[model samples]
Target: MSLQDWTEAELGIHGRVLPVMQAPDAVLSAASSPVDPADPETVRLAADLVATMRVSPGCVGLAASQVGVARHVFAVDVSGHPKARTVHGTFVLCNAVVEEATRNEKGREGCMSVPDLTGDVKRASRIAVRGRLPGSGEEVVVETDAFEARALQHEVDHCDGYLFLDRVAGAHAVYARQTYL
Candidate 1:
């Protein structure tokens, strides 16, 4: 089955697909706070984040702040991207951080919140991410490369209140991805 199909088959989602907060929304610009990974609320938020991201066409990730919640939590799934070299399936992470990173590489990236633009942002080609798994409170360390690394960095940046535009190489590095296919 495709990633979209997997995303569509909700296992335990209850809350609605939260709105994708756009630019200029203070929530999207402010750093998010950490949450208890074991909290029921966090689990629900994860469900909503994953659902919302899956529903958004071409969205591979979504952060809590983008859903109007200022929490250090996000969901990512890059099972079927052409550029992906490492895949993590679908996962919800809380209190996530990049523990280690290396190999700077510039790549085009877009966000669900910043739908109007795409930018060529410099990011680590390989990254080691640490985070709490929602509902279980278990800590996970993911070492990934290629597009998966880029996706994790993008979502983590959102947790830190930084968007792709903020990391764009230059004005010329930004582009209109309105026709992203």
Candidate 2:
């Protein structure tokens, strides 16, 4: 099924809001293992990611590693962001990969894990991603632009064990967050 057609309820699980792991945590820097999308545990993790992201203000996406799980799973929802275009609503993907990325642009980005900092990083303004749904394990391809693309790339970076800080041009591009999100 397409990501647009998928929903959290299909997982048949209730998710708990997991604590977001902070940067410098070993798990946040370690690459995640691919998960069996249809596995019960993977489904539950996916749900938990969504739940956690929902409660974190300004969190448009989340990954398993951010929640202290080193697995290639994440949830993303950029529906109402000012820069979002072609949003797919809220959906989880396991073993996601960026198939194509283009139109690089620099933008300020913040993370729940790196709560004290924000950075100006260059990211693709358009992208195409491929992954499997949490419950049914159905493969889906999502093509999007603007903030949705940025959010997908950010979560994908998490799955690969990289943070926004890693993508910044230099120390000059990083700054202390003035306000808490």
Candidate 3:
């Protein structure tokens, strides 16, 4: 099934959103395990990733570790963000690997796990990622640029036990998020 179709189908069954595991959670600092793409639990986790990410404001992606599952899985979509130059509708990946990355640039990034802060972190402006689809065992490659690339890197980092904070240039690179209405 296409990513959108899979998301739509899963949405009905997993309308329940999983809670985001916040910072200071040990899971966030530990490396996650590789997930079997064909497992039924992978499908359930994918659904939860999508559900949780969708409900969170300004959230473009989420990793399995962020939901207390230390597995190499993540969900991402950058379809409508103002900064998004390349749009990938919504999709989940298991055991994702960054095949290529180029053109490093610093960008503003934040995570649901670390909700109080945003940081300037250097990331590739373009990247090629390879992984398997949840429940389908289909190998897929995602080649993207701009915001999508940054989002991909951010989520992949979670699977590797690193947060945007770990990539921040310095203490001065972090900033408190401003609240406004």
Cα-based lDDT for every prediction: 0.86, 0.91, 0.89
Decide which is better by TM-score, 1 or 3.
3
Model 3 agreement with the true structure over 1-181: per-residue lDDT tens digits: 5545457374344734888988899999999999898787888888889888999998999999999999999999888899999887999989999999999999999899999999999999999999888878788888999999999999999999999999998999999998789
Off by over 4 Å in 3: 2-5, 8-12
Strongest candidate by lDDT: 2
Ten contiguous residues minimizing lDDT sum, candidate 3: 4-13
Q: How accurate is candidate 1 locally (lDDT)?
A: 0.86
Off by over 4 Å in 2: none
For candidate 1, the per-residue lDDT at 85 reads: 89
Candidate 1: where are CA atoms >4 Å away? 1-12
Instruction: Write the number of the candidate with greater lDDT, choosing between 1 and 2.
Output: 2
lDDT of 2 by residue, 69-154 (tens): 99999999997888887889999999999999999999999999999999999999999999999888989999999999999999
CA displacement after TM-score superposition, residue 50 of candidate 3 (Å): 0.4
Q: Is candidate 1 or candidate 3 better by lDDT?
A: 3
Which pairs, if any, clash in model 2? none
Locate the minimum summed-lDDT window of 10 residues in model 1. 1-10
